[model samples]
Target: MEEKQIIIRGRSYPLFRCHTLIVGSGAAALNCAYHLVSFGVRDILVVTERLGGGVSNNSGSDKQTYYKLSLFGEGQDSVYDMARTLFNGGAMHGDIALIEATLSAQEFYHLAQIGVPFPHNAFGGYVGYKTDHDPKQRATSAGPWTSNQMYQKLLIQVRQQGTEILDGFEVISLLTVGEGEQKRAVGAIAIDKNKASSGLDSLVVFQAENVVLGTGGPGGLYQTSVYPKDHLGSTGVALEAGAAALNLTEWQYGLASIKFRWNVSGTYQQVIPRYISTAADGSDEREFLNESFPSFGKMGTAIFLKGYQWPFDPRKIENYGSSYIDLLVYQETVVKGRRVFLDFRRNPAWKGGAELRFEELESEAYDYLHKSAVLFGTPYERLQKMNPMAIQLYAQHGIDLAQEPLEIAVCAQHCNGGLLGNIWWESNVKHLFPIGEVNGTHGVYRPGGTALNSGQVGGYRAAQYIAECYRESTVTAESFLELAGPALERSVGLAEGALGRVASPNGRIWLEFREELQARMSRMAAHIRDAAQIERALAEAQAQWEAIHRFEFRLEDPARLIEYFRDRQLCLTQLAVLHSIHAYLQRQGGSRGSYLVVDPQGSASLEQLGPEWRFRPENAELRQWVLQYQFDSRTHHTAWEAVRPVPEDHFWFENVWRSYVNKEVFRDSADSR
Candidate 1:
């Protein structure tokens, strides 16, 4: 074939090589970049396919219920709460020191000042509550697009710091120097912004001493994914760079992605099956849905079967501490000849919202008034003006959720385990720092809403560390050009490889492989696991590796996708998965949140509905909602008989009282307090 090469800027550029290269631009990547800049390190180059949110765009989980609220518990959740949650949430083997010390709570607050809007409660207050393992309510956020919002703000900060952003560029590998002993990461190899490799541009030699690998996780390896991100921009690249791929095989089943082929792709095209709710007495209520599926068929099937139908606590339903939907619940349904459903029409919320025709307002004042009206026992019509997604889903779909139950299921979502690294976001290898969905800072089943917080925290921490650590390194134009050379050559070869002979075989086979993988992974990696299942999964993953090696591939980008799959396979190796799975199983103490001991038949304890809340039911007409709640402090502690009592031993009464208030948090998350 004739040469398809070109020169640019008076220089013949090769593909690979660069100094201070970042692989992803998601929350993790952006956060790290910003944090790196904050550290006073300037020779930063961020190479990514996009500059927006991470995996969150695909997260269809109901976001109306916020994470931060006026929660009054033991510690009143703060930056400290994040550390506690990570420890309690089975990140026992994680780099707790980094999390404990580095995550940026102030940075999260700063995002708000940067124009990211946080949802206000009816009283126009910054709403917050104890969600899952978070102590107090420090998890302030800006709607469901927290990741997107954070990414936007962080991107602005990154650019302002004078770092060059190469968007849509594919990073092919890490550029190392010295033979072996003197081996160090000076930079990375990447294609130009167009993602072309006909000839390398800016090849090999963006020279800088400290390189950080912020490549993302390995979720794309599965046949189905919440991430429509193509271009082989995943942990596979980190692994290919020989970063000792630790805990890679220990792939955490992200919020189970559904199996579906959207008319479109990427997170924006995500569609969820409607899920309905009914009163505790089976007196049907409205349906509410926010959860998104990476896949539909599988997720729909899981939900059709209904919860392990775990009941919500009447008293603390908002917190829903013990009401975690078990992964095994769906697995059992499948194993027992039953399948989950993706029903939407039956959910109760849709019908009521359809009947109401109310649109929620975005202001804080109305929210407080709505609650005030509820405090005085106002009519239902006034409450719904604040809740719009519910109404829109109903009116738009014309499906009365009250009359019918909405179908729902759990599919894979985010990657809890990614390319392993230190708390600083650096992979085992030098210079490359894997961040966001690609970084495996978390183990399996990350607590709800933690990804945003963690990414922000990790980014800030990594940047600060890099700046302080590499204050002596030089980052200049000439040095960068020097590092760009080798990378150019590598990019050209890989781009050619992408277009060479390869076959994906049948998409059907790929689907089956994914299903089998899920089944194996779920059993071995679910809420409660056993040694046998872990070993079994290890064996199966090993076999799959061999099979994938034999599988055909097309020499297009999907070929890189094939390589991506292998990256996930390497991640699934026994070392990664077994260590954490076994670690989770090994912790032989109390179980809270999602973890529960399965009976021999997989039946576990159903928790009691502890308390009841005075709710202001939403109604039609006003189209603007308000919320006002009045509760006697004396009544806050409902039958929390099992909770420990506050000690009068020379301590702040509130802190002491929270021990009694958040008994479950202390007991459940252990470290959150």
Candidate 2:
């Protein structure tokens, strides 16, 4: 790799040339860097806004799971079986599913080998348990910090391998060349937060043959989001660079604590804490669930089931299923304008002061509580008995489960869709790979903890493809300048214009824009959706997207320029997501995945909710096609492609060995950008 300086708008900015430029420092991004070094590809650079600030290091549930191939006492399990399960999830490419299934064990072992501390039996067998949407018992966990441990272990490996890391840089634009099939990712332009206070000199450029985008999901799009505060995603820049998005409408929304921004899943709900609501001024508190549910047993059962069925699935709403609790919470916080809280200090109160008799509860809930020996205590006591770590975790963040109520909301947790990638995790743009949550590998439905597995598999696949096929760059310094010149000029112009604008000292322009965008997304594009609201939101998003480009900013602090760029990225991402949702509604798409599509002529209805909450069932046939959306800097385009079927090819050992030795395994991967 070589370092130089490039002048943009009379300000000299740093530039580096490398074989690969990784645009994040999360677990997946670090894993890619480690694998690149192990594969003998050393000319790589990693850029991130901050180390250990993304979701991988900062988010978890009560018992964070890690999905992988069953390695021990299994009734039966195979790569083909796992592939079929992932493929059947709907709107997922069969080949990509096969790749992920095939690599699950390898990635799992890599984590375990690098001190992830996954529990094992005395016989050295890794036991597994069932998770949501999983047929086989293929989920495992170390504790509540499974992904955080993975991030820490992988960071050690990456640092040990001497991979160059550049922190405090936020990517603003991807450098690309050509158009259509010939298009390719050259590098990226980033805003140096540390140097932004020095004005236009903050812009830095990277010239590389391949760019690995491991940035996480679009977490900034919603006001009520569970993603970590520091990890606002950079997916908008890739979309602006013409990366097609797939299944953008599929997202996971669930209950999470707002104060500490942690998931309140697993034992937190299994303990059956009291659900209460209060007036805006914190008075008039009452047990809200008791008024809606028919009996203590039914309500208790629903709350217990929420431990595992955490995500808000429309299918689970009828008959007071686990997700009904999600709807009730949504009703209280969003619809009724009340503050909802989980009172762990006491068990839920039944109508007429009827006690919650464990034996009278549903067998599933009853058996689990009986097996865990937690049938005789308050919710916090039961939680302390089952998992004291859940309590300590909150204590670490200044929240005590035993002392006070925990405020929560039905918030956006994860996106099941993102930039479309191939079997090797390469996007349509040649040389650009989107791994981790940024890559749309998961579909309408996925097993719990599958995102972690997919991120590792994607990093391994992307690294191998880069090392074997794209080992060096062909662009010299002169050619690199020609390619990145226009994009550089546009970014500098935006920065200059924003800095020159005048505003009052109290005006936090970025915060104003961010709140407006997040509020609109949470209202119109969250778990509950209506066609009319989506259409209106789409129009409003477009106007805001345009407004962000020309919005004035106070030069009171140039170091705050990263916020302006982040706001722009978030605005574009919100616009693209709205376009996707509007397109889905136009196609007569209905309630599916993690969200509900409300319609006036719908066939389904919730018991306690009004006609306005009536929703249409999913269109079964739509599951056979993946929704591909693109925004080419002007108009939003939508296309549908049939789901690729699982591969049925017979593999001959000798033939496979020949292909492996000849380096033909990556036949579809690009050798140059």
Candidate 3:
């Protein structure tokens, strides 16, 4: 390794050289760094905007789960069953599901060994519970902070392994070299947030042989999002570097507290709160769910079911499940021009002025409430009895859920799609790997806690692959400088152009543009989707992006520079999402997962709801295809690829024979012969 430095604005910035550079400070990045050191790869650097500030460390709810196959269940349970369940979720690749399922248990136990406090029963068996889209009880928890616990433990391990972490350094761009199959990721350009904010020109260039992106999802891009407001992810950078994105239209949206931005799910929903809608001025109060459901018991049971059925799905709309509650809430709030709230102060009342009866509720809902000892009180009292921490957690964030009704709405929770990758987590750009939320491992729907598991699994796989395959490869300073020259020029030119525009009196600020972009996305691309609206949004977004380039910036304010770059990245990502949605609608791809395409004929009539409430299903044949969005830098145009399924033969005997024929089984004997 050689020392390289660059002079900028009369200040010298060091260009740190390393074997591997991991972007992000969350569980996935930490785990990857730890595993890399364990594999004897030194000179590792972990760069992040903030330490312990990612969704994994900052977000939680009532008993957050880490989903994996049962470690001590009945002998009938197997990884193949888990894989099938995952694959059947639609829009997911079979091979990816099988790989994640096979590695789930190993990653789960590894986290536990690293000091994650997974609960075990007296019989020395790990207890498990069911989660969304899961057929088996394969989900377990370490209280609500399951991911945070994983992050803390992994952070400790990474520190102990002597890996250097550059906190507050946000990676702005990925540097790549060569062309086509010979192209490879060599390094990245980063800016220091603290120094930039303090009016200092501080930038660090990292030259590495391998780069792992664990920077999570595009949270800041959404106006109504559960992700922390400051979570600036790397998906945009990857896309700009010509990496293909998978299933950009698929995402998870659910009801969360408006004030705290925390998911009001599980026990918070199971207790059956009174859903009230009011005007923005706090007038015109009405019990909204009662208007939507035919009976109090139906609405109450749906609320109870929301504990597991969190994300809104059109398929679950008329299925007598809690997900319909989300549709109703969205209709009431976004469509009908009303504000919604979850009032736990009292039990829900029937339209006929009858008191709620326990027997009238569904059997499962009644049993869950009974087992939790929440059978006979107001929703607030029941919530306190069931999970007191839920109320207290909100209080810590300056919202008293117990005293006041929590304002709620359908907000973006998780992105199921991201940078496309193989089983090793490597993206199209060689030497560049994406892990955690940035890796598009999950498809249309996923079980709760699978994101955390996927992050760990991806980190482990990427680490092993890098160590086994690229440890001996040389990444010289001269080669890195040569490869990074064009990217560097582009970044510098963009910055200089922005600085030049700052002299104009009518130039817009980055914040105003960001807010406008978020508002437009929330209106068109978030939960509800229509062809006209999405196409309009794409056009507007393109205009906004073009307008953003004309914005002026103060050279002294480094924060503005960071925001400028982030906003640009977000605009590109938003365009990708909207274009994907537009193409899907054009191809007659119907609503699956979190995607809800509006029906033209207005088929739905939930209490005579408007056209926005009407949803139509896609053709059944479309389920066999996955839509891929790729940016072609050569033509400066976006291209779409339909990934159709290939024939798969999964017979057990055939698999064994194939393994033998490939010399995977009894490899030593076959090699000797």
Range of the 10 consecutive residues with the lowest summed lDDT in candidate 3: 664-673
lDDT by residue (tens digit), candidate 1, 1-673 = 0112334345554433333566677766776776666666665677665555345333333231223323333445443344445544443343332253234446546666776677666765565643434445644545434555666776787777787776765555555543323345666555444524333332333445566555455444444334443422345445445544332322322232233311111111112234333433545333323232222333332332222122111112222221222333233233333333333322212323332111232223234344544222111122233333433333443544334433223333445556545545555455555556566555323344656656666666566656655456454444544544454454445534434433534332444555566556545554344445666765676666555444423433332433334343343332244444444333332232233333233222332211121122111211111111111211111110111112223647786688657653224332211
Per-residue C-alpha lDDT of model 2 across residues 1-673, encoded as one tens digit per residue: 7899888878888898899999998889999999999999998999998888898999899999998889999479998998999999898888888888899999999999999999999999999999999999999998999999999999999999889999988898899988998889999988888887776678888889999999999999999999997778988989999988899988999999998898899999999898999988999899988888888889999999999999999999999899998888998988889999999998777874965678778999999999999989899999999999999999999998889999999999999999988888898998999999999998899999999999999999999999988886677788887877887788788887777653446444777778988999998899999999998998888887777665643535677677778888898888878888888888899998999998988988874777787789999898898888888888789888898888876878998899889887678333311
- lDDT of each model, Cα atoms only? 0.42, 0.88, 0.79
Q: Which digits, one per residue and each the tens of the lDDT, describe model 3 over residues 165-284?
A: 888898888888877767779888888887775323556678889999999998877888888878857688898888778788889999988777789889988888888899988898
TM-score, structure 2 vs. true: 0.97
TM-score per candidate: 0.60, 0.97, 0.93
Superposed by TM-score, candidate 1 places the C-alpha of residue 337 at a distance from the truth, in angstroms, of: 6.5
What's the best-to-worst order under lDDT?
A: 2, 3, 1
lDDT at position 465, candidate 3: 77
Off by over 4 Å in 2: 502-508, 552-556, 668-673
Q: Which candidate order results from sorting by TM-score in descending order?
A: 2, 3, 1
Point out the higher-scoring one by lDDT: 2 or 3: 2
lDDT of 2 at 558: 73
